[model samples]
Target: MTTRQDGERRRGRRPGGTDTKAALLAAAREVFIEQGYDGATVRAIARRAGVDAAMVNHWFGGKEALFAQAVLQLPFNPQELIANLLEGDPDSVGERIVRTFLTTWDAQDGGVFAALIRSVASHDQVANALRDFFIKNVFSQLASVVSVDGRAELRANLVASQMIGLGMVRYVAEFEPLARTDIDTLVKAIGPTLQRYLNGPID
Candidate 1:
């Protein structure tokens, strides 16, 4: 029933309007899970949301910021995570990674990551979205930092296993030993194993 003129008038009247932002967020989640971070384009997300591609920039700044808000719901931007991890010496990357991750989660006060884990536990779609986010954002970034001969995918998976396990135990279940332990102790205990996964020779 709507004509082209009506559509043009609506588009021009509310560029990146409130409703458009919500639609973009929902569409980006589906597209990100379907195509992943590296494959999902801003244009595709905008098209899915039925908005102009420039609306993405106007509403969320860019794909990375949009993704951070749409998926993680954390207080910080995920795109900066890799740059933060790679700031110091390469030899201590594992230590830095563990420390940074724990610090970030703890600071959230069971807000972002906890909700994500709960959603992932309850729904397969949410789980797939979370998996894609981790694989594309966290695992791939860390794997890229290591130049070892091992399969980066394998290495990334191993790292994900350790970190994700630590999160569930330390944050969700609140295991006494790990939950009570100081951050330094955790870094010392878990960092070496992650370091080996990153740079050590695998058999």
Candidate 2:
């Protein structure tokens, strides 16, 4: 058994604990940011964190899970979030989506959004990660539920555009009343537009 001092000195395979997990998360975040989701390896992250790569599997299951937690920092699991949004009135999913998004990102004070945008800007892999994160895992699933007449792809694109634009203007550009507006106020203003995107008829 590796004692505390021995474990500290060895630094090869860290025993499971809050500190080891935290170190892995911090290291994963940095590695994902620097190398992006595709390029960032579990071994590299574990090496940086001074832990065994197997610990990543123990704590996070795998690289994708680690990326989701450390880099995406999602407020909720992708599937759970989708399911929750789908539970309410079908017509009102758009509003719920907008509300949930604003509330979650707002709670983080835009740090996650800003970091993702920066990563997407600096790294192509990050852009792909953003696409997979938002488009495949989130928006497309939502669109598949409510979209009309095989328009899931288009609806997904529309929702992504609206949300990404809103995030950019509010978090990145820091433009005027929008950046300062209360969540409910923005939701009321933007909800209908997204509703139309999701529920609108396409010819």
Candidate 3:
């Protein structure tokens, strides 16, 4: 009953089932790079992946999450990560954020983040994709949640500046003691400032 196309599908990517996630991620990356964030549609990515559009929702929760995983190459879901970051003692959220950031990048030896930093320099789409993502998904949401001073937007940007700077120095620039500093030390040192950005004065 098996056909040549079936054999080929078995060797490479298939229409649905177990291959859906990988196929969708592959397709999402292509579509996001080619179409940009605003232009890339769920149907288009699903069509490219040769799967049902609902599969995108089923696997990734929706377009934004898909973009985060596919384009940003983030290891976890942004929304869920934010929600988890919001849990427990509110004051320590920034510490958790720093810890999580270091852990995620360190696990990959900063390879993924390093590549992203490099790609952002030369590729407009990559830069646009990154701007469309972390700024909105990670920064805005987390900052907004803890913001009591109505400065969520500014706070978000500040927090972002810190993380972006940290990534560049530690991963890309490979600068000094900061690069070799342990995650715990970085968290303890940077966390209070981040907490202030999210909850403290910015006048």
Best by TM-score: 2
Ranking by TM-score: 2, 3, 1
TM-score of every model versus the real structure: 0.64, 0.75, 0.69
Q: List the residue pairs that clash in candidate 1.
A: none
Off by over 4 Å in 1: 1-73
Q: For residues 19-103, what per-residue lDDT tens digits would candidate 1 score against the true structure?
A: 8898789888777656666667997787777678899999888976776677665556666976788777888988988898888
Q: In order, what is each prediction's RMSD in angstroms?
A: 8.2, 4.7, 6.1
**Where does candidate 2 stray beyond 4 Å?**
1-13, 16-22, 30-65
Worst lDDT run of 10 residues, candidate 2, spans: 1-10
lDDT of each: 0.75, 0.77, 0.77
lDDT of 1: 0.75
Error of 2 at 178 (Å): 0.7
For 1-203, candidate 3 gives per-residue lDDT tens digits of 33555444543555567688898898887776676666789988877777778889999999877876886765556678777778878888889989988887787656556656665775676677778876767666675456767777778888888998999999889999999999999999999988888887778
- Write the residue-wise lDDT of candidate 2 on 24-85 in tens digits: 99889878767765678998888778777888999999987787688775555657877787
lDDT of 2: 0.77
